[model samples]
Every structure is written in C-alpha cells, then in structure tokens.
Target: MEASPILIAIDFGTAFSSYCISVNSGHDTSKKTERYETETVILFNENQEFEKFGVEALTAYTKMTSSEASRYYFFQNFKMELYNQKITENLMISTMDSKQLPALKVFSESLRYLKDHALKALSETVAESLVLPQDVTWVLTVPAIWDNAAKDFMRQAAQKAGLIQDILSENLILALEPEAASVWCKQLPTSGFIEEQAGILDKSTVQQQAGVQYVVVDCGGGTVDITVHEVLDDGSLKELQKASGGGWGGFSVDSKFTAFLRQIFGPVLWEIYKNEHPAELQKMMHTFSIQKCTEKEDIYIECPHNLAKLAAKNKDISSYFSQLEGACWTDGNIKISYEKLASFFTESIKNILEKIKEILDTPEISIDFILLVGGYASSSLLREAVKREFGSRYKILCPYESQLAVAKGAVIFGTDSKIIHSRVSALTYGINMSRKYDPLLHDPKKRRVNKAGDYTYCTGLFLNLVSKGQSVEHDEDAQYTFFPVDDDQTEAGFRFFSTEKLNAIYIDEPGLKEIGSFVLPMPDIRLGTNREIHLKIKFGLTEIKANAIDTSSGEVQKIKLKFMSE
Candidate 1:
C-alpha cells in the first residue's frame, strides 16, 4: 500500500528560510497526524567550490577566507527585493561582492537547496522505501501583502527549482504566510510538540471565540504583514480586514546599525572595510544578529585591526568615532549601549505599530487579540516594544517557535485550505473591452467606425469583475463572456487592470495599473463574429488565475498571464 501523504512546507523568508514536513494519518484524532518536523537551510561556502546549504552551509561559510567569502554568494535577507517595487522579470539582486544575480535565479537556488536538504533529512529519519517525490505535497509560504506578480514569480522559481513538476498541479500549493499561521495556531491542539513548546494545554484558548476578532502580525525578516480575522460559531476564520504592511521589519534594524558603523568609520573607510574585510564584517554582523535577539544592556562588536589601523591614519575618521554618542571604542571593540541599540528598532517598530492602530481603527472590525508570529516576532526587543505600546488595549500573544509558525502552519494548510473561508479583495480587478456606442454614456469623439461601418465605442471600457474591499470566497471564480468584435479575428486579447477605485473607466485612468494580459487563439472564423469566449478570473486566492474557453470550438485554454512589461 502507498504510504500516507507527506506534506512539505517551504518558508522562503527574507533573512532565514526553513521547511517543515508532516505525515498525515487517515484518522482525524491520531497523534501521528500532527507529527511534523522542520529543518532550517543554512547558506555557506563548501571547499571553495560550490556553496553548501543548511547547517553545513553555515559552517563552511565561517571557515572560508575573506577573499574566498567575497566570491561566494551568501543570500540572506534577499526576499525583500520582490517587494521593493513593481516586480518584473528583469529584477536582479546585488551580492555582497557587487555581482548582479537575477532574483529568480537566487530564489530558485534557495528552493533547490531546501528541497535537497529536506529529502536527505527525510531519507535519514524515515525509511527510504516509504518516501518518494510524488508522494509529497509541497506548500510554499508567501507574504499575504505581496502582489500577484510577486507570487507568480515565486511559483515560476519553484518550478525551476524542481519543487513542482507542474505549477497548476494540486500537489503544489501556495499558502499565504499570515493565513497559514492562523490555521496552524488554531490546530495546535493536535500537534504534540508545538503545544508543549508553547505551554498551552488547550490550544483552543488561542482560537478566537465566536463573534471575537483577532489580528495576526507576521513580523518576518523583510516585511511585516498584518491581517484581521473574525471567528464564526463553527470555528472558521473570515478575513475582516484586507492584508497590508510595509518593509519595516527586523532587517530595517540591522540596516540602521550598519548605517551607524558607516557614520563612525566614514564613507571611504567603511567602503574599504566592506570590500577588503568582508569576512570580518560578516562575522560582526552575525554576532549583532544573535545579540539583538537576546536581552542585553549593551553589546560589543569587534573591530578588525586593519580597520583600526586605517582609522588611526585618518584624523577625521578617528575623531568621528571619538565624538560618537552612546558608543565608544575600547580594546579594539565598539560598545553600543542599550539605548543606542534600541534606537535601531524604533523606526520599524513604530511603523508596525502605526499599521496595527490603523487596522484597529477600522469602522466595524473590533479586534480582541493580536497574534505575533515569524522570525522577527521572536525578538525580545520587538516583543517588549509591542507589548509596551498596545499591551493594555489589546492582548498580544506570541506562541513558541514563532519563527517557524508560517512554515509549520503551511503544512497544516496544505492538508486543509478551508480554514480561511473568505478574504477581502485588496484591489479592484477588471478587463478592458469595446462596447456598443450609446449616445447617453459614450462621448461622440470616442465613437469609431468598425469594419462593418457601424459606429462602436472602442475606447476601452473597463468591466469590473472583482471590486476592491469586496469579500470573496476562497477559490471562487468570477466568470464573464465576451464576443469577437470582428468577423475574421483569429485571436482575442484581454487586458487586465487592478485599481483601488471601484469604477475605473479606462486603462489610462489614474491609479489604474495593468497587471497582465490574456490572449486566446480563436478557432476557424467560419463560426463568425458572434463566437462567444468565456473568461474566468479569480481574485481571492494568493494569485489571480485567468482562463479562457472558446465555446464555439469547445476549446478550453488555461491562461498564464504575463506580469512583466514588454
């Protein structure tokens, strides 16, 4: 008999990435059903040849020389690039050595590493006879606030990484990070390990009671995603507020600390240190990362001798450090005070708090609890700051292994996606098409003579399919039918646009952005211009899916919309 279905969830994060695997037994109450294991992939060098991954990668990177390390690509905190702008096919990431690498290539490599590591780990833990690639269902966790283009980009990279044989296969799933965390937390009662670690005897205590609302704040390395959910009597979750967030996350704190170093060392010396002493800088940054997670009055970062020597020669650089406040150099190490360290977190923390407040201030949503999850959510400093800001007004709950919540929750989501019944549309999605000219609605100047000499308004009227802020059921498809405008037309093109306005008149309207286009090849023109094509679009899922069906030829085509600009 085939073994039970194994679900694997890959959390491709900004600074750290990890995977969790779970085997689901047929029985609903079986303890075996909740057993899941996770492994974190580490990035490091291997024998100065190829980069190693997982724990081995971390070790190898540490042992490499400065020059060797510079040549090696260690991608951490790289996922933020996807959210930096309107993601396109040409987006690239710059490595520490100033080499430009395609973002998709980097993401695929990371996925490949995670897949190989997970397989090797499974082979060692479970009998090799029981595990097979086909038996596994892969779930990739993504930030809920990411655009359709970014999500599609991840799907493509996952395909390139060999995680999924086909993107449309049910075996592969994309679980929104915040939704996954909410589901995982709700189902923690079945998990033996997570419940114990979280010190919760009854996992239902974390579940929002009927009529109560809660907000999940996913504070990952690169982005902070906030969403509000309402609990129904049947224990189902309904998204009360649309997902929203910014780049104010843990990496922002790290970036501020780096900026502080640049201030003390001066730009010229800092550039020298970054290029010439990358290994030392890496080590220092790693130390800082560890320290930031723990509570401390002050932290010391060791300065390289070469940096000190250069600093001594430059009077301006030497004076800069001497006059710096809340920091001092002694014994070749710079001591940063707790006050100064906390300043690094203030900006990001404030941004997150403001977003939370904005959500809570929404007219009808009454959030009772704020659930914190993700890697940055595990930071004591961040935790304390959050509690200090809104602890009295709202209950803040940070479960154990908050960093792994998204990945572990993703595994549960792969088993059942109905945990989140509905989600609010973030934007209005529609298509532009020509319509019959009406004197009452159409401007006379917009009317044009068609092939048959009939006056028709070809000025791209937007047909709204999904309106912004509208509640849509999960996996629900909105269908619309269109007919060919010309009798001999061999192809039909649909231009899709998303905007914040409920009624966008045209593609050129302000605040309207074209997300993608769907092209359908028509059948024989003998069917005539009245041939109807059914276009289906779904907006509730993580990515918008479009399909076109030629009713005349009985040909159904799955439209893979291209997000990049030509």
Candidate 2:
C-alpha cells in the first residue's frame, strides 16, 4: 500500500519563521493538520559549532552569562543579507560577536532544524511507525521581490540541509511569499479578514468571487513585497502587476528605535554596550518588538539595567532624558509618547504608502482593496497608518494571524502550483546576440567583422524574450530559434540580460545587466551555419526555467545558467 503523502511548507522569514503541515488523504489536500512558528534565530557555541535554532537559540543565548555569551555566536535577521546582494556560495555572515561563518552553514542548519522538528511532530502522529522521506513534499517560501540568484542560493541551502536529494528533485518547491499569501487570501471567506468598518458590503472588497481585484501587501520583517491580483472566472488568480517593493518592513521600525537609542546614548558608549551586552541588547530588542505590535497608545519599554549603567558612566543619565524629545526616563522604563512611538513606523509606512500609490496609479490596474499580510502587517501603528492614508479610497483588510498567512498559503501553493494562472514580468529580459549590422541603426563601436571578413554584424544586439509588465501564463513558453552566426562555430551561447527600463535596445545599455549565461555544445559541425538551437524560457513561474533543443539530434537539455562563482 502506498503511504500517506505529507506536505510541509516552510516560511523562512527574517525575524521569524514558520512551518505548516498537511496530509493529502484522498482528495483532501488543503486540510492543514499542524502549524508552528518561531523566531528565525540561531546560536553557535564557543567552538563556532552549531548549538541551537529558533526560540531555543534565543532562550539559551539569553540565559548565558555575559562572559560566556561573549564567546558565543548568535545570529538573527540574517535573511536580509541576501537582499539585493551579490550572492555566491562563499558568502559569509557575521554573528553577534563579530565572528564570521559560512552563510550556507547557517541557512542550511536552520532549515535542517525546522525539517527535523516537523518530522518529529509527524512521527508522534504515526504511532511508532516512521514517516518515509519519499512520502513528504516540502515547500519553501521566499520574497517575490528577491532576484533569481537569491532564490537559487536558498535552494542550494535546502539541498545541503537534506530536505531533498538533489536540486532537481520534484519533492521540493519554491513558492514566492506574496503569491503564496495571495493564494491563501483567496481561499479565505469574508469573515476571515478584519475590516475597520463592520459589516461593510463592498462587493469588490467583501466578496471573494470572480472579478474582484486586490493588491496583496506582504509586509514581512525584512522586506515589503507587493503584487496585484485579479480573481478569474475559473477561480484562478492572475497577476496584474509584477512583484515590487523595498526593504521597508517591520525591521525598519526596529532600526528607527535603535537610532533613537543611539542618540540618547553617545555613539562610543552605545557601541561599547552593544559589544559587551549583546545578549541583553537582544533581549531588550525582543521586548521592544512585542511592545511595537501591541494596540496601545502610549508604550513603556523596560530599559536594560546594564544599558542604563553603561550610559551613566559617561554622563548624567538624567541630562540625557532632559534632552530627549519623544520619550522620558521613568521607573526603570522608557515611557515613549504615543507620537514618538508612531514615529518609529513613519519611514516604513511612508515607503509602503508611496509604493501602493504608485501601483494604484498604473493605468491598467483597478484595485478595490488592499490586503495586508505577514509579520509586519500585524503592527497596530502600521495598520493605523495605512488605514488613515488610503482608507477612504480603498477598503483595508488584514486577516487574523497575519504572521502565519505566508506559511499556510505556502502549503496551499505546494498542493496546487497552478493556482496563480499568470504573472507579470518584473524586468525586461533578453538574450545578447549578433545580428546583421544595419548602418542606420547599429552603433559603430558594436560593429564586428566575421572571420571570413566579408560580413559585418552588431555584436551587442538585444533579442527580447519578454518585456516588463507583460503578462505571461504560468505554463506558457516563449520559444525562439537561432542559427550559428559563423559556419564553423563550435558552440552556441545564450547570454541573458535584464533591465528595469522597458525600451532598452542594446545589451550594454546603462541600466542593462548581465544576470546569467548558458552555453550549448554544438558537436555536429557538419550542420555548420545551418544548425539551429531552439530555446524556450518559462517566465511566468517564480523562477525562470529554460531549455534548449538541438533539432539535428533531437536532443533536449535543461539549461541552468551559471551565476556568480562558487
């Protein structure tokens, strides 16, 4: 008898991570059985070896003595290291003690811990029977705004964690965070979400039926990922705009709070305290994080005794409070004024509002609702800010347990990858090719003479594969056939380039960047210039997939573009 198939979805976040599990019993694939979430933190012992992960890591590190913790390496919010970063296999991240560790080790071990935890939970339910790895499917969620290199790096980490046997394993799925949330939102009823106005019946906003258009703002700890979607008649979701956003997220508020702290304490003293009291600082920040999400007017954050003592060493602590504008030093606490606490969210909320307006201004999009999800979306200040700004024009809705939306949504997506019917291309993508030189259009500098010295070609001509904002169906492919430029060409290479500007004409344009490249071996020289390579790129999925077919030999090969060096 075949074993019951299990699906585990991991929403690996910057400040927090969560996993959701579902068992596919007959036709019931979306029934969630278990869900768990924890902080995205890891701690290493003095030997620089792995110690603990998630909540355990935070607790253990916090319990250690200052001298003992000084030698330990604790890492949190490390996911932001991959944002707009030049990712490579050798990338290293710094821990609390300013010690460096291979980024791959940290990511893989964190994932490994989550996988083991989920498996352990499954084991208990099976009653003395072991759950076979083959019966489990894993889905990992990443921000939709992340580049291909970052996504590839996460996949490599998952492989190293033994989540899957190989990169090409069918058991592993990479689901975009915003798209996953959109899927989860679609499955929810009108009652699942919280609206400032009670019993409001705006069809577009309240109803979850066809033709309802909304924008999903996945505000997580590291980044705010936004995407527009329209409900289709077939119950599938179609993306109206590509995923876009900035680093303005929940952590941005924390940064603002930290800046305030630095201003109160001199820079030198602050640095010393951060270095010496890293564990205490972490605990203080953790407390601030909780207070930040509470729906309260005036907030009081307990000051760490050590931080206050350190500040007192340099100057009068009372003088510092006297000069403070938005907060006062109270009984062992910092009594932050309501206006001051709101200031922490100002930058993040401003950026989010601006982006939302930009998306709404698009001529083609007509959104009636703004759906907020993720850890940051749960912030009361952020919610109030968003509602105050655009509440009149659009209905603002935030679901219960918004933090777990991504993880639960990922499970739904893993069960049905086709839930999102199409996606808009985020960037204009093209291949660099040599074309017959036209005197009127081709640049003189790009003109190249063939080895035969008879014909001239433009070396940096852009062969457009997809344009920015173009909607592409999920399973559809953009096919193109190309012939060797030279008769004796030993290989045909496809150099991929992308740019934010839609009107880029050349591969070397100012904004154009060479992202990746793949080379196809042309073993059959007899075909000469007549040999043709058929290339197809799937642009609608979360990650681009490409394949090449040699017509002469009917050989098809999957093309994995080489990114940065290992």
Which number leads on TM-score?
2
List the global CA lDDT of all models: 0.76, 0.85
Task: Tell me the deviation in Å of residue 416 in model 2.
Answer: 1.3
Pull out the clashing pairs in model 1. 42-54
Assess candidate 1 and give its TM-score to the true structure: 0.90
Residue-level lDDT of model 2, residues 1-566, one tens digit each, is 23236888999999899998888633233454787899999998888788999999999988877788899989998999999889888999997658788899999999999998988887886425777555688889999999888988888899899898867666888999998888887777677786645544444333257887889999999999999999898878999887899899899999999999998887888888888989988998998888887666778888888888987887767678897898988888888887898889888899999999898899977887899999999887888888998888988888888999899888878877887899999888989888889989989999998776767888878888899989999999999998887777777878998888885778888998888887888777687678889999999887788999878767677877655556
Q: How many clashing pairs in candidate 1?
A: 1
The CA lDDT at 563 in model 2 is 51
Give residue 528's error in model 1 in angstroms: 2.7
Local error of candidate 2 at residue 472 (angstroms): 1.2
Model 1: per-residue lDDT, tens digit, 338-357? 99998999899989989988
